[model samples]
Target: MNEYKDASKESFNDDFCSYLEHHLTRAFANAEDELVQKVWCDGVLMPFFENQTSKKSVNDTKRIVTKAWIGQDGQGEYELVIKFEKYSLRKYARGSSLQDCVPSERTLDWINIDLARRTIEIQLT
Candidate 1:
């Protein structure tokens, strides 16, 4: 994983969120490598709900969407592959701290956005 503590000073915006957003967008837009992350689903978030004392769903907006990329698992003959990841702090183990907040797994659900064909193919399996 790349560290954000030592990137170009000018490339960062005044707002930290904007800085992360801009960097994430640029990172996705100019990627020259293949990235296949471990996937997660609603099941991954289940423990949070199960352990909550209150009878409510997780309505908080404390997500970190810094990892976006084009995967390379089966790159040949594929086009316009991308991934937008959202970090889940609640997915960490009990008593885990900030270090556990980082993404360590990902899954694939293929989605194709063909600009020339102007068609979208989604495979939710």
Candidate 2:
């Protein structure tokens, strides 16, 4: 009476693939860079790692960025919080936050620097 008893391995695999594609599409909708999507598709999603976190050092501070979306504050300023080991930093933006998550490697998609606005919009494919 097991739920998977009647299902073949191939059928189960296909179902899993379909489910993955659906969730990937949803994730990509909010993604700002094609590189991020590719990394998710190849590394995280394919490997079944739903959540991921990365660390980077800037201005002598270790910053960490995760897969979860950091919601905006009441002042309409969106805070992109990153964690570095035990410490965390928050980067604020006026509009939506960009895809700045670190992949498996140290590579990062460089976006145009706008110091005046303090924002960077990543161009997604």
Candidate 3:
């Protein structure tokens, strides 16, 4: 049986969420913003696409914000859903990175990490 199907439904506390957010931030501290966004989405969504039941189309333009929080997965263990939002380039956008893009107000995607299995999953719309 798939481990995800047998996993328990539990919520991670605020401390754990904070730890995860910090961890991801540190891991990608030297990387470019676009690279960080790509890594998170690819890491989490690859498994979703490999499953026979999934048939969702992903928008690659979304960017990850390195912010994570506990989120329920219905049947499986609670996951850390990393925030991925839309970003658009503006000529006047100022930042340390030359390729900086302005982030949208709302999240456009999520990448869920299951700590027990060290796996990532997401529900695509």
- Among these predictions, the greatest lDDT belongs to 3
Per-residue CA lDDT of model 2 for 25-88, tens digit only, reads: 3454355655334322211112122222211232144422222221121121222223222211
- Relative to the true structure, candidate 1 reaches a TM of 0.18
How would you encode candidate 1's per-residue C-alpha lDDT over 7-98 as one tens digit per residue?
21221113422332233333334433333121111101111222231112211322211222222221222222112223222322121222
RMSD of each: 14.8, 17.0, 16.3
The model with the greater TM-score, 1 or 3, is 3
Output the TM-score of candidate 2: 0.21
Of models 1 and 2, which has the larger TM-score? 2
Error of 2 at 81 (Å): 29
How many residue pairs clash in each candidate at the backbone level? Answer: 6, 2, 0
- In candidate 3, stretches whose alpha carbon ends up further than 4 angstroms from where it belongs are 1-11, 30-34, 37-125
Cα lDDT computed for each candidate against the true fold: 0.25, 0.28, 0.28
* Candidate 1 whole-model C-alpha lDDT, 0 to 1: 0.25
lDDT of 3 by residue, 67-99 (tens): 233223223323323222233211111111212
Candidates in descending lDDT order:
3, 2, 1
- TM-score of every prediction relative to native: 0.18, 0.21, 0.22
